[model samples]
Target: MSEFIDGVITEVPQQYSPAGELDHRVHADDHSNDWWRHAVVYEIYPRSFADSNGDGAGDLRGVRSRLAYLAHLGVDAIWFNPFFTSPLLDGGYDVIDYRDIDPVFGDMAEVEALIADCHSYGLKVIIDVVPNHSSWEHRWFKEALTTEPGSPAWARYHCVLGKGVNHELPPNNWRSVFGGNAWSPVKNADGTDSGYWYLHIFDSSQPDLNWDHPDVHKEFEDTLRFWFDRGVDGFRIDVSHGLVKAAGYPDYPQHADRAKRSAGGEIIDFEPLPHWDQDGVHEIYRAWRRVANEYEPMRAFVGEVWVDTAQRRAKYLQHDELHLAFNFGHVGAKWDALDLRERINEALLHDKAVGAPTTWVLENHDVPRVVTRFAGVELPKSSGDGDENESADDALRRLAVLTPEQRVVGTRRARAANIYMLSLPGSAYLYNGQELGLFEVVDLPPQFRQDPVWFRTEGKVVGRDGCRVPMPWRNEAPAYGFGPDGSTQSWLPQPSAWGALSVQEQQGRADSMLELIRTAVHARKSHEAFGETDFIWRDDIAEAIAPGRSDVLVSEHGGAGNRALVVLVIGTDPVDRPDSELLVASQPLTDAQIPGETCAWFSLS
Candidate 1:
């Protein structure tokens, strides 16, 4: 039998000769040059990026209009969130059709145009592909539900039979990333027990397909080929870990008593689930790698592995698996210099052993904005004393607390973080609006909340809607011109103070956060060390910071060179020293006596 291994063509010889004859040689050169290893990826949320049509939402045309802006940013690639035909469930993660573009986004032609335009501007386009599950409205899922259990279409999915049987029984103890039961009861149109249930790792609306099925594998392979045929550069796989599951779904062990509350009056159960890091996942990834190899230029597949441990995270990046797995440890770490250093060191060491690159991200549409998470200071409510309605004075008072110098310090800390992430030897992902120092919207009205977690978690999680607010494009236009019409309200409301943070205002102001981002990106592009470089952290400096104190992180980068590029990050809080060698500060570090917030690049020589 012939099998494709990691996109390489290999043939099994019927019999081995006494002299150890070779059957076939795999094409080692095909998968060797992966551009994502040293590229900077900029993530764009299609619905909020720009509006080409007068539909109040962003479309492909809108993205086309912004090609120059992205090219100007100096990122090598753009990872567009799914613009495929979807029911808008889970923010387009519930893909309805893998082949067609959503009507709201544009037609298939428009997508191709966007890709062509991006390529013309020297930018690579990577689309988000949700293979773990599909929208219940997907044609295949609909056919599976309607067709007989033994039919081909039925076999294409994980449809099982009998109430509480394979269908009714819980797949295992695995819990959905979103809170609640992972299984959804399947019923026939006649309202009787179908004698089986379906597994949805996330929402009931998203039915997880069984990858163990041979036909299912073939179907996805064809889908991958379809996109490759369409000239897509790569795929940012959603929930990359959920492609495979344990043989039998088992119950996850409860870490703490749900009936009891902790000192913070919060239910605390943060233990690891038994089946999260399953062994079967590797096989599925290897299979995807085989499919990716069939195409030229070797398409990239970056996975989102949400594990806290470095070893488990590194496992996803094993040579035959994904090109890069999200290094989420950095994203989840506290905003302390020392903590960041430890996480980066762990990632660098683990990836070096596996001979795989890492992907770094500070913010994403699915999480709270990094600025809000690390700003160190919280804003006061619109109402000064917690009242619903308040005068403009309350807003002014809140703004007053965040002085220009404080804002500069905060922005600088963020810039330092960016320098640390981009300078590392891996692909770096910059979330949309991150360049503009976008913060999470403080309060979202009930009607404005779109995240399912808000409903299941009872508002305790704050949901992801705050971070999904529309991008601010212009300062004077209504709603900052994020919507199709300048006067139209965006799908996701613009943050209250977004008018002041518009792209136009930032572009005009040299000192704006947008300019700072542009400078950093250009710096990364101009430096040869940033591309295909190796990181080497100073052991003495790393060891100096206290284990628990999250201040002052330091790292050095060198690859076959006598001199090294060093980066020093200072946290928002005050530093111990009055003066030091300021290599570069994201924003001006007043505490460090840094002249400006701009990143200062220097040669160790």
Candidate 2:
């Protein structure tokens, strides 16, 4: 018999075992279909990016208006988060209609125009695809809500019979990633409790689909083709680790040390829980890849996979599977040179084994802004051990309760991190406000909060609203020029101090983060070295600059005659400058020393 302990099932009478082996074999393909390998992709959360209609919300047209700015920023691609038809719960992740655009975001016509505009400006468009779940208002979910058990509509989702005799309890002890029970009890028309329950790994409003059902697979494939037919360059898959759950809704294991590791501190990878990081998820991606390959130029797919280790994360990037998967190790690592170096090496090594390029990201719509995160606020010490789970929402939760932002310190560290990250091999993702040196707006009033996480947790967790605050484009304009003049207040309030951080204020300033990022991005494009997926640590140079010092990290890229070196000084003391043509520096090099907490790039002849 099973018993509930602290809202989790401790044991189950009948347990479902998962498959022991993973099918890691991938399709044989050449390097011709690889556009994202070294691409600089920018993630634009549509709602907070720019407001177009004076409706206090950003729309597709708003993104269309910003094409010139993005083109000038030198990003190869723009990854727009879902503007699909939705009720706006979970920030559009709970997609209601796969084919239609939400009225608030604009219509199908605008999306096509925006895609065309992006292409004209030499930008590839990658839209967010939320395949794990759909909004409750979705036709399938709504029908499942009223259908009888074992019905076809019910089969579309993971609707199962309850455990108890009276069918009062959830089928299993699985808990929602957001909070509360993963199972929501079904109800009759009169609102009486029905004997069936459905699984929702996320919010109750978002129901997890039954991948075992062929209908679910067919629908998503059709959805993919729908956008691909409309000229989307690729897809940024949301919750790519999800979608396939364990066959049986088994009870979640309860243990303080849930992660099993080897003596060397590497995660002894095993299939995670009944809900997450399952092996079956790979088969689905392989099929999706076949579909993507059908197109000319081949639409790419990048998964937002949060697994236990870099090795496990690499599984999603097998040749026949996703083209790229986001690497969170770099984001979750502490702001230490040694820690960052180890993580970078691990990711590069693992990704290289799969013949895939590492997809690096600093911050996103769901995490704390890098500026505030690296600021003086305390971060949990990382033991230089690999924990790939830190890239997910749970890790963000820990950051939600951080100390207030220290603007000067955070901005400096952020600028340095960008220079260092951009110099690394493989692709890099820049969040929308990252270039403006935006820090987390941690002090927004509680009443103004809109993140579903903030409400679901009943104010216990502060949530990601801090990073999702509307962008500040102009210092003096109302709502910082997020919307047109005389527009309604922004959906979320912006900090008053962002006036100095606005693009208008930083545009021409050589010392501004925006200019620095622009310079670094252009350098990455102009140089042939950054195009390759090979970089060697220049330990000899580091020793030459700061003899026997472990604080200075230098990497060399490109060929001998036209090589480039990226130097990062992480210690308190400055290092002697290298004898190379200066390309760009996070901070002004006032003298012959590279200041501590500064990163610089130099051209070597």
lDDT (0 to 1) per candidate: 0.67, 0.82
Q: What does candidate 1's lDDT look like per residue over 440-518, in tens digits?
A: 6746667877777656555444456777788888775556877545457777778557888878777745567776667
For candidate 2, lDDT tens digit of each residue in 1-605? Answer: 01101111111011111244111111235564477888999999999999998888988898888888888888999999999999988899999998999999999999999999999999999999999999999999988767776789989899888998899999999877776789998887788888889899989999998889998899999999999999999999999998888887788875546677799987677658778888899999999999999999899999999888899999998889999999998888777889998898888888888888888899999888888777766545542322333333444444533443466777888999987888887889999999998877766788988777667767556678888988888886458889987775799988777788888888767788988898888888777656543477777779899998988888777653446778998876899998777888998786688998899888766
The positional error of residue 565 in candidate 2, measured at the CA in angstroms, is: 1.0
lDDT assessment of candidate 1: 0.67
Q: Backbone clashes in each candidate structure, one number apiece? A: 16, 0
Best lDDT goes to which candidate? 2
Off by over 4 Å in 2: 1-33, 256-267, 379-405
